[model samples]
Target: MLSALKRVLIGRPLKSTELGEQKLNKTKALAILSSDALSSVAYGPEQILLVLMTVGMAAFWYSIPIGIGVLLLLTALILSYRQIIYAYPQGGGAYVVSKENLGKYPGLIAGASLLVDYILTVAVSVSAGTDAITSAFPSLHAYTVPIAVVFVILLTLLNLRGVTESASVLAYPVYLFVLALFVLIGKGLYDMATGAIPQELHTPVGTPVAGIGLFLLLKAFASGSSALTGVEAISNAIPNFRKPAPVNASRTLAAMGILLAVLFSGIVLMAYEYGIAPIAEATVVSQIAEDAFGRNFMYYAIQGTTALILILAANTGYSAFPMLAVNLAKDKFIPRMFTARGDRLGYSNGIIMLGICSILLIVLFGGHTEQLIPLYAVGVFIPFTLSQSGMMRKWLREKPAGWGIKLAINTVGAAISFVVTMMFFLTKFPQVWPVLVFLPVLIWVLLGINRHYGAVGEQLGLSTGEPVEVIEGNVLILPVAGITHVVEQSLSYARSLAASQIIAVYVPFEREEEAAFRDKWSKLHPDVRLVTLHSPYRSIIQPLMKFIDVVDRKAKENHYQVTVIIPQFIPKKGWHNFLHNQTSFYIRTRLLYQKDVIVTTVPYHLKK
Candidate 1:
């Protein structure tokens, strides 16, 4: 029944041989991979204006400049990531580049930062989408967190279906969003050029919060940097593209950067010309749309597309995080479960983990996009700097054809990204300090995981010239509560082993219970001897463990192997298992760690 439900939700299982068919073409790839960058226009301009608003209307003058600065950074990222795509077409992105060129610690840092940023990408994108919905229909404001969480779950299930499937589902909305924004920008610019709409002249009306200075401009620049959060995703997931993966991915990335620059700068410029201010209920884009189209169908069309692309933006994280995790897992820096693909050929574990973590952030932050922006930028720029620096090192070390130009591009990207990262730290220290603390702790945890994998490999590995020996004699012990069909089945399997001796060990809470069990054993005329252990505290596992210890010592001394056979009853219904004592479960669990002792379970299925 569960399998049927799963099939219905995520579609039928996809064969492994169909993996190549799941690869995306450029148009679908653009929608699936670039949505996060494209959708940032919804809130990126607003975040910039949010900071500049502190200084009153006059401070709004800096919005266009800040937007330009963010665009320059976007250009650098696009060029740098194109280099990354061609260089590491196998696609681990910053983590792979940093590890190969810089070192292990830097790679892990890049990995951890990207992981955090991807999670925040889902949370912030979904939250921003929900914000658009609530802005359009004020009544839904109270359910923002719930709505955002629902979108996360929906996207999770969609991606779990497979890459091509999700691209097919999301491609239309992404293109529609781009068209709507282009129309908005084109019409707004036309109006401004022809004086069709009256321009509101602004003078400083309220007291400036602080004197406009380098610090204020830097803060605004740092805040606006959220627009560049998902720029690296294309490089991270190059393998998701079709033939000539790097070229297709690079083209998609360039297209995304162009669209983002046009939309983000258009919105910022339009906000300034139309006297749009940050409102608690309405979004900056929504207000710009209203000013352009006056709450008509076009206004709602912009809001609708904005909401959709924003929600679908989370798909970028879904695509990137799992692939990055696969690399990390292959390196033994994380659990191996992430390396496994599900029936649909998606990284199910990684997708589910991303969903769960994003939902947590959404709930904790109450789905507020502004609150998550600081965390978003801090995580993003760290990897951005690391990736570019790693590329710079690569160019310097290899010195391939045209290495100097590539080196200069990556160096400029690295320097600018490093400065932006520092600015985020300095200006938003109160909000971003947690990310600073988290990055180091995450690095420590990743190192610990690597050490544990190393230790496990060393301990479990065989040495050269080691001989494999087998014991001829077998000593079997069964822990039985009472004689029943379950016990009989266990005894039958034990007898088939042809052991040297078979002992039935029983632990009884009361003296009368032991006496009754002894009588039952005699009535059965059992071939095996019965050993009774008293447990005054009624602890089943403790008394049984002591007896097993004694048996183990004697067996080893006599060169015999000890095998503990446990009789476990299988209930007809899963929930019915809760009604039983589960004594056999405890025995098997405790004996699993015992050296040179074998444990097995004989199951008796229940009809009712």
Candidate 2:
């Protein structure tokens, strides 16, 4: 039943050979990979306005300058990541680039930062999308947390279905969002051109919390840095593109950056010219739409598509997190299970883990977008700084064609990213100190994992000139609960091993039961010896383990191997097995820690 249900939800198991077909083309790739970066235009401008709003309505005049600064930063990241796409076509993104060019510790830091950022991507994107929903219908505000979590689950399931399939599924809404926003922006621009009067937004002017100073402007810029959150995703997932992966991925990255700039600039411009201030319930974009189109179909269309693309924007993290995990796992810095693909050729474990973490974050933050935004940019920018720094170091060392220009671009990108990261820490640290603390702790954990894997390899590694061991004979110890066909089958199998000796051991709870077992054993004229043990406390495993230890020591003296056979029976149905005691299982589990003792299970299948 479970298998049938899984088949229905995620579809049937795909063949390994179909992996090539799963790779995406440029258009679908743009939809799946670039959605997060593109969707930020919906909320990115508002984040800047939100920060500046603390200083009263007069501070709203600074939105354009901050927006331009964000665009310049965005341009730097685009150029740097395009270089990253070509330089490291194998595509580990920041983790690989930093590790290979810098050192292991730097690489681990980059990996840890990207991992945290991806989780926040889902949480922040979904929360922002839920805010969009509440913005449309204030009555649904109470259900925001539940709505966001449900969307995360649905996105996770869609991704589990397969990459190509999920991309195909998410592409339409992204394009729709872009088209809708363009119409709104164009209409707003036409009104401005035709000398239409500005609508009174009736924005509540809050008391000024901070003066208009350098710190205030930088704080607002740091807030707007959410626009650059998902930029690294394309660089990380270059391998997911079709043939000529690097070229296609670079083009997609460029296209994504261009769209982001235009949309972001247009929205901010519209907000300023229309005197649109963000209200508690409606978003800046929605407000702009209402002013330009006035409570009509266009207004709700922008809200519907905005809610959709923001939610679907979480798909960016869904695509990149699993890919990044696979890279980390390949390097032994994380568990190897992440490297395995699911039946649909997606990294199912990583995808599901991302979903679980995102849902937890949504619940913890109460689906508040602003509360989660502070934690978002630090993770992204730290990696951005590391990646560009790594690239700069690479160009200086390798000095490939056009190395000087590449170095300069990366140097600027790295400097800008570092400054923004510090700005994020300085401006948002009171609320975001946990992330600052988490980055170091996470890097330490990654180092510990790397050390452990190294130790394991050292211990398990075989020396070149080592001689192989040959075993001549073995001692078979069979543990039996009572005289039954299960015991008979165990003894027969043990005899076939041609051991030096076979001992059938039993732990009897009562003297009467031991006597009856001995009488039956004597009637059979058994070839193997029978050892009986007493358990005053009815602890079966304790006496059995003690006896096995003694027998194993004796076998060592005789140069014989020790093998313990556990006799068990399978119930006809899985649920029926609960009716029987699991003593055989306990004995087998206890024997697992014994270094020189071999354990085996002999099963008697029952037909019902």
Candidate 3:
């Protein structure tokens, strides 16, 4: 069932070589990595205003302090993670940082945190983008979930085409967004300085609170800190950059940090100057656009830019989630399938998996950013704290040249980040604690289960120290339906196996047909053996299954192995697979359970 759903949602997996020949240069890789961080410029202001809204417009000034705090944290995180790229250029990001210094449990914590953060990145970005677009066209409001799902599907397809393709497609729009936003914010500032500014735009209504409290402060900080969610993605993509990966990666991180800080600050200052209120439904970009341009062409342009950036922000996850999953799979924390690359040389399975989960989240949350925000920051902050702590630990353990200086800065950064993270849980846990509790427990349980299974298989001395064994046998038995390409391929395969004996078994439904089949076999291969089994019940699977059991019993007595080669046809497009492969599938399943038996499949292609 999961396979069917995967096929319906993600499409067929492609080989790594099929991803195309293009490699990402540092500029393009940076753009791709920065998409998530740059995207925060659109909604980061809105998130702050969201928290402050409860306190009324009089408290909106708090956004400035919150933004500054977040910016400081962002700068520290960028610097700290830049060291991460330098230390581990192979690109494990937070996972590598925690694992190498803080040990396996911390590594797992980081992995789980990053995983959840990536998932929320997709959900929040898509929902926020959808909200922006819907604001431009009110008719789209009711179809937000559908639109988000379609967007995710399109992004998944683009990612499957290759990372370079996705980056190329998104770069132009993201750049346009940066240009448009910069222009808009610049225009707003110029008008404010020149006294040409329009009257204050009425902000969204909110419940008035008496005063600022610790809870409100923590909530504001948590909302502001979400801007840092994708800062680590650049570190993860260090390996994907051109030669001199560390130098290129660090340079890219620097550029991203400068641009993001500027953009984030500009948006917040502009929103504050315009007297824009905290909007529960609209984004800061849209609110600013509406006020600055008053629903004119420039307004639409800013709206378009913000919407595009939000959608492209998910590209950050597209770029990072697969790499993290591949890393986890390498460590045996995730299934090996996630480690496999697709035709685009990207983590195709991981991409599709994330896309599906994100779409489900969009649907479940009704594409509302506010509803999903609670589950958002905890994952990101957990990793941020742990990763910084891990780097501090590494600095202490190694005591390398200049270690003292780096350690002092990292220690301070880690301490501050850890306190903020704890505060986030305390303030947001009423809403987010459930996810924090659920995701970690779930990940640990899965890890424990995998370890238990692996340990048991190791004790049993199984192949590759894993529970599953690759079946091997010699005797070839092909279940055929007269002569076809499927039969031809099965015969060719059996010949290749070079078994001591080959048997073609068929279950005859009628007496005359059975006699004619025997006569034809007698003429075709008189020297070779042909077994005819009668199914008076006219059942295909049962007779073949019984015949295979009998063959297995006989082969064991004679000290021979049984290799069942089923001649199965590929189902035509739009045809039910169960009707075509049920017999062979049952026969193979039943035979595999028996001792000294191997199952092989020789697939025959069907014409379109």
Candidate 4:
């Protein structure tokens, strides 16, 4: 069923023999790696205000410090991750760092956190984009969830087509967003400083609390740190870059950091100058436009740009989810389904899964940016703390003369991030505790699944006790229905397995057909053994099983194993399945249960 669905969704697989291949050049590589970092410009500000709104207007002032802290964190994270790119350019990201330094459990923790973060990146970004669009056209407010779901579907389809194709389309909107944001910030700052700001521009959301304390301040900082969500994405994508990966990745990281700091700081300053309300439901970009341009064409342009950038931000998840899923699969922390590559050389199953999960989140939060904010930063910062700690271990291991400098930087980064993670967990536990509980249970389940697979492997004798070499033999047994082209192909396959004696077995359901098959086989291949088994109740599988048991007994005596080569007819159309019997499928499955019995399928193509 999964095979049929995969074919329908992603198209038929291309054989390696059928196509030429080329490697990704620097431009293509840069676009792929930069997707997540470029996406952050969308929701970073909204996340900051989301928490501040809880304590009213005075708490909004904390956004300045929060934004500054996030910028510094971003820089520290960028520098630390630069070391990761240099050390493990093959692109394991946080998972690799933790595994190499910490233990497998830490690696699993990192992997799970990364996976959740990627999915949220998709949900939050799309929901935020929908919010931006609704701000411009209030009618969209009613259809926000549906619209966001449609975007997820569209993005999934584009990714299934190919990474290069999706990246090409996304690169332009991201660049446009950066340019428009810089221009708007520059203009807003110039206007504010010259005393040319409008008199009626200010609109405060709530009154300040006179006795706000440290708890409120920490809460605000945690909210602002949400801006750092996409910082780790580049580290995860180092393997996707061109040759000399670390060099290219470092440059990309630098570019992302500079742009993010400028855009994020600019938005905060502009919001403050315009006296934009710290409403939980409001986006700073929209407020800045309303204050600076006053419902004019420029305001409309900014709204459109903001929406575009938010949608593009979701594209970050499109690139990260599949890669993270692949890493987890490698480490046996996720189901192998995530590791399966589609026809387009992308993780199609993982992409579809991410889209579905994102859609659920959008529905759960009712597409409200404010409601989803509390649940956002907890997963991201946990992984950030672990990654920095891993980097500290990495620097200690290398022990170069200049290592002390890097280690000091990473140590401070780790301590700050760790404290921030704890602060967010404490402040937001009422809302986010459910996720913390849910994630550990999910991780434990995954570990149990991997253990089960290991047990099965042991039972199957597929696991090596001491990794010794052993020789194995192959045998082929083709199940023939009648004397036709399919039967002929089966005979040919049996001949190919002549190294082990080839046998063609036929199950007789009716007397007349049984006689006919015997007569035809005698004429076709007189020397080859043609065994016939009678099905008293006209049951195909029962007769086949009895015959295989008898054959198994003979093979045991002779010390030779059996290989069942089933001749399957490939259906050209879906409805053809109803026209033919499913005997081959049942036969293959039954044969699999017999010890020392191997199965091979020789498929026959139906005529066009």
In lDDT terms, which candidate is top?
A: 1
Query: Candidate 1: lDDT over CA atoms?
Result: 0.91
What lDDT does each candidate get? Answer: 0.91, 0.90, 0.80, 0.75
lDDT (tens digit, per residue) of candidate 1 on 1-608: 89999999988998899999999999999998999999998888888888888887778868877888999989999999999999999999999999999999999999999999999999999999999999999999999988999999999999999999999999999999999999999989998899876745443333354578888888889888888889999999998899999889989989988888888898888888787889998998999899899999999999999999999999999999999999999999999999999989999999999999999999999998988989998898999999999999999999999999999899989998998899899988888999878889998999999999998887778954456656869899998888889999999999898889999998999999999999989779467899999899989988888888999999888888999999988999998989887778877888998888999899999998
Which lDDT tens digits does candidate 4 get at residues 1-608?
88898677655676544322312444554455554555555556656666666665555666677788878887888888888888888777888888788888888888888788888888888888888899888866789899998988888877786666677777777777777788788889889789888745443434455656777777667777777788888778665565676788778777777877888888877776676774534467887877777888888887887787787677777777787888878767677888886787777788889888988888888887766656767788888888889889888887977899889888978987898888877877787886768789878987997897777767778445655433244445667877777778877767765556667788887888889989988998897778888787888788777777788767767666777888888888878988988988888888778776778888888876
Worst 10 residues of 4 by lDDT: 16-25
Q: Estimate TM-scores for all models.
A: 0.97, 0.95, 0.82, 0.79
Indicate which candidate wins on TM-score. Answer: 1
Residue pairs in clash, model 1: none
Rank the candidate models, highest TM-score first: 1, 2, 3, 4
| Candidates sorted on lDDT, descending | 1, 2, 3, 4
| Predicted candidate 2 versus true structure: per-residue lDDT over 1-608, tens digit per residue | 88999999899999999999999999999998999999988888998988878877667768888999999999999999999998889888999999999998899889999999999999999999999889889999999999999999999999999999999999999999999999999998898789784445423233243488888888889888888889999989988999899999999999999999999999988888777676788888889988899988999999999999999999999999999999999999888899999999999999999999999999998998888888888888889999999999999999999999999999999998898889888988887899868889988888788889998887777954556555668999998887789899998899888888999898899999888988888787467798989888898999999999999988887778899999899998999988988888888888999988999999999998
How far residue 383's Cα lies from its native spot in candidate 1, in Å, is 0.3
By lDDT, the better pick of 1 and 2 is 1
In candidate 1, how many Å is residue 137 off? 1.1
The clash count of every prediction, one per candidate, is: 0, 0, 3, 0
